[model samples]
Target: MDMEILKVDRLSFRYPEEDRATLDELSFTVKEGEFVVLCGPSGGGKTTLLRHLKRELAPVGTMDGSILYRGLPLAELAPETAAAEIGMVFQNPEAQIVMDTVWHELAFSMENLGLPPAVMRSRLAEICGLFGLEPLLYKPVHELSGGQKQLLNLASVLLLQPRVLLLDEPTSQLDPVAAREFIQLLHRLNEELSMTVIISEHRLEEVFPLADQVLLLSRGALQAAGGPREIVGRLGAGQAPAQLAYLPAASRLFLGLAPQAAAPPPGASPLTVREGKAWLRGLPAAGAGPAAAPHSAATAQPGAAARAGEAALLRCRELTFRYAKDGAEVLKKLTLSLYPGELLAIMGGNGAGKSTLLQLMAGLAKPQRGKVELGRDIHTGYLAQNPLLYFSQDTVAAELAQMAEYAGLSGEEAQREIARLLDIFQLQAVIDNHPHDISGGQQQQTALAMVLLLKPDILLLDEPTKGLDPEAKERFASTLQLLREQGVSIVLVTHDVEFAAEYASRCALLFDGAITAEGSPGDFFGSNYFYTTAVNRMVREWLPQVLTVKEAIQQWPDSGSRS
Candidate 1:
């Protein structure tokens, strides 16, 4: 068998208006029956490379070199033929789905390709069974959870029975459980069907262990490519300086004080929590040095003016909302209060109404019952889960300029702020580009910048880190910390439990339309059930109160000061 099912030979691509190539001399290959994961920071050409694999590059771009499928040059093949053999599941499911219902969406692709009714029906059933999507067959696309939509996208593509599957960050929008399930299904497809899978993703801990091959891309170039062990070993050696350092949180915590403590043995490698735990258990405990220091919680002095005034920044009383008359209530008799200088995270399963709750809080949707009251002096800012919806203007700069006008900033000040945001997000060159033309992460940053400029007393964000790479997520977290220090009250809904555990002051778990638990981040994440970070889970067995690395570090005796 040909080892290379798909190959890029010194491929280079550049948009017409861009001075530099978006992808320059990038080359890689995916073998039959192999699972490959392509990872890198945003705007590093992972998406561009995937687009090239599917032959979906725009006419304004120029391509150099060749892409071959089964030793046949892909550029020479008809578009339909290429698409039929090379199935693609896009980052945004809504962009590719054309039909209303899930059943129609699954069947539409095969029907358009002229498959017979019998073949289509059999294929659909097989795909649904393979992905555990049988129950979602008749549901409308809009009604499905973010994860379900991703699964539907995959199922729709699987109906074609393509030789190679190309997934572009398919699980980025899913909750933790749903994301894990999706990855497991993908593994089954690769094992049972021997389908070649090429996925670009940021959730490394979820996908890395399952990947047969891992490729790292940086600055639109292929920086490294090899099997998972080889690539990760090179990363551990600090060879890929430009790539984001995304060690397992557990490993990072221990390695911080004991730099060489958690390094894998000569021939052994561990990437996920389970593997790391096994590795940790095998090693004898480092001789207990000093007793851990006593816990000292910080306390704020009275009459120290709070970030925002004493006024209630955001409040909800008996909030209730339902999707339809017959549908189950999503937010049932929920009441909450948020003050300035507080960072609160709402977490739950995919269908637990986290996004719905955020929309209601942001005043984007009306509650079916009860009341949501904003303080008289409070201004509200919102960052949506799908930031693309916030873009009405054409260019990135234009969007910020419009937001500046609304915020009563002078043109010069608006320009300065826009430049500052663009610099921080590393989107300086793309400021004049259309929002739709940029990557999803860049668009998210732009939306966030616009929201921050509003400087509202309360900010509402829905999955702000959904599609971002690890580096971007870290940067966004730091930015949120700065905002909190400035007296902004943040109410964010996300599936990123680790982020919540690290950054949030308080956390609320939503289930069946109501909050089942609420408390300080430590208390909420320390619980075994509900949404909790991996680090929290790891240390829960050892230290119950440790919810974050910072907290764990502080628990150590030698640590100097707490942040």
Candidate 2:
């Protein structure tokens, strides 16, 4: 039998002033070399639990539990041993970085560990090559993209060759491509180095299939814990619970198609696109006839009311921009138009200028060449990737009220609006807490609430779904749809292909500082083999128009109502 590398026994914790515990009676064990995925809805205590595993980062809270590393109390471990053996990467990479350049950052860890110069040099060389950070060795940390910074953080942590790694949504800020690469790297480390990995992630499509064990938590309690397939079986049939929306797309689709009375065979639930495709092919006469396209949200053409030969709400014409005078152009002569009520999703790899384009559209940055034109009396609200930057107030309630007041709503109007937002974002419990103390998803929701208070004509959002759980993302999409109904145009820069595919009215591809392609979701995703949604990848050969689980279910003749 494998040895237990870490164990948690009846662990429970409540933050200061919180009404209830954040983590309640959680117990589990992670064996050596196991790839464990810690997943749950937003604010479900995944981060709280991970912090308890590392001595330095554990928060001050009421506790009734014990955590052990190799049969010893984790808290009793020496400071140096805890620091060297337990490596953690936070959600925001920028928060972990302190050095000016990539080389310095990687070197700083080894220096603190008191590793000899020869050993440090050898380790740095190996880590730099592993993360492909060699080219960026001398590059300034701030000049790097979000994905690059995240990779640097991981590389730096791995330089210590920790026996156990704790990652709290490390890929939340990364683009799709970068996120996949990061997960793959983790898998490699776990397999080759026998590194114990305990990762908390909202995006489960990639990690789910690779996880040796999956733990589901909700409302500060463990709902289930088992292998990936076993956990899916426990979810029963049809749609997963709201808190369990992190289920992989393949698993979700399989659950939808399976008969209500049937339980998935032991270790038979499809968790990856490949297994899903094989299972679909095994079905007798699957998609025998042309699958009828379901009633689509895209039926009414995007921006029909706002762009029926009407002038564009915002236009970027031949825009070129660079952060420094001698730096390479971020956006090169890029021209695009945003129609009113258009939820335009700009997708691209890291450093593809998607965020820069949003900054130009929001009028936060001026182009080195050409111009950005706005429709008469149009207002814009821009939400940056780091939601914490958008807040100046100490508390969540104060932040929302301040924004409401700034928007000129007074008396009962401001009160009603703030109340509505608190309900909509499901932030009632955290209203009195400091904005910085909340979970990342909560912070993003709070920031979005503040932006909506502005009531702008156009919304510029950069990776707005970064830290949100699947259910929270659904709520966010509904909010966007409501805004669209009110004729608000939105420019969304995101790496979430699934969200863009399901909710975006139009999707645009940015590459090499220009718009490479732009079209409706169907056309945009159907054409891309590798970059499309998991549902699209699973059913594309038979149902090319299907880009979401709901759409895929519509095409399935026997797919009954999704509960």
Candidate 3:
């Protein structure tokens, strides 16, 4: 067996005010040069366990355990000694960054530790090169993109040359491509530098292939621990929640129509798009006939509803927008309208200007030319992709209450409504906690709750479900459905093709700052050239309109919903 670098023995911890323990009798070990992944549902004590590893948990909390580093008790080490030996990259980069410029940010910790100027300069160069941060060294931390900011954070931590690195959902704020790139970089670091890595993240499909071991956590306890093959096998068998099932997009397709299709071989686990495609191609194409094209019922008349002369709730007449001093337009002579109570999803690849268009609609960025008009009496609420920008209060509850008051609600009514919204987002218990005290997922839920409090007639959400688990995503979809029933229109920008197919009534594909395609979710995703959801692509071989696994299973021909 590999040498044990760290160990947790009979560990248990709880918050000062909590009656129940946050970590209950949890024990685990990290081997040198190993990559371990920690995952479970939200608020399952993953973050608490990470705190214990870093020795940052408050001593006042109830404890019945110890953590060892290299056979030495962590509690015996000095705070500075521990900081130098155990580098931590938190989930939120903004929370850890202390300097305005990227270069200063990387050097802050080294300088604080009193490293020699010559040594610091050399280490900075080497670490920056590894993370591709040379170009961003002089840039202001505030000006950097989300992915770049995260890379900087990791680079700063890497400067310490710690034997073990703990990353708490490091890429939760990044896009799909950036997230994959970051994980690949970590894999290389482990191989070349021999760093032991432990990551708690929701992007399992991206990181599972690189993990040496997987640990499952549930309700402050270690539910299971094993190698990737064993964990994936159990997950494929439906022994895991829908969120932790790392089946690829292709397998998800077959699993929807035939749950047994997700079963892996005796010793192999599938966790990538390539692996899934291979598995799917290898399977016998046995099932019902090809599904009919999406929205075949509506495509026969392209503009039937438009020809009926209904007024649009929001309209853009040849809208065009561009940043100051940039001659090139970001939104070019585009025309679109959002009708009341409609859930519209906009899909696109990276740098396709999906976010820019959403910002234009929300009035955050004015169009350089043309017009964007909202109907009279149509209230609007906008949720940015990064909600951290809107936080100002010391605690989550206070923030929600302030927003409620802004909407002219009485203090008592606001408190009541805030309580209800917190519960909806599963944040009731953490209401009084500091805004910075919660997890990334929890902060996102808080942001969504804040927006919903306004009760707008139209909601503009940009990547609202980016960091949410499958269950949270489902709940959000339900909330949107409820809002639609209450006569609220939704305009969402997202990369979740599967989610769009499952919940969006209408869909538009944005490419190069323009809408290349527009139709119902089925119609938009049914195309051969455009991007599509896993379930839709898989079911396209048998059922045309199936976009979600639940829909496929519940409405399968044998289930008696077929005509």
Candidate 2, 332-403: lDDT as tens digits = 999888887789999899988888888888888899999999988999999998888988988998999888
lDDT of each: 0.76, 0.86, 0.74
- Top model by TM-score, which number? 2
Clashes of 1: 0
- Which lDDT value does model 3 have at 166? 91
lDDT by residue (tens digit), candidate 1, 1-563? 64889888898989768888888997777788999998888888888888888875433588898889888888788878787888889887778878999999999988888999999988888878777778778888888877678788888887777888989989877888888888888898899989888999877767787888888887788888887766655665663333525545554554443435345344355556676556544544422333322332221111112323565577788899888889778889987767678888887888788888888888889998898888787888988777888899989888988998999999798888777777777778788888887887888899999888888888899888877887888888888887788878899888887788788887777778887667777656665443566665554544555766567556543444322
RMSD in order of candidates = 4.5, 3.1, 4.5
Q: What TM value does model 1 have?
A: 0.90
What is candidate 3's lDDT per residue for 1-563, written digit by digit as tens?
A: 68888988999988777766878998888889999998876778887788778876433578898889988999898888788878888777777888999999999999989999999999998887777778778877876645567788899888988888999888765655566688988898899989999998765766776788888887789877888767666666664546444444444444443435367554554455565545444544424445465454345224215533777888877778766565456677887778877898876665466777777788888887888899999878999878787789988878998889888888788888887787678887787777766666777889989988888888999878766766777788888998899899999988666677789888876666677677776666666333665555545656666666566656555543221
Worst 10 residues of 2 by lDDT: 295-304
Q: What TM-score, to 2 decimals, does candidate 3 have? A: 0.83
Better of 2 and 3 by TM-score: 2
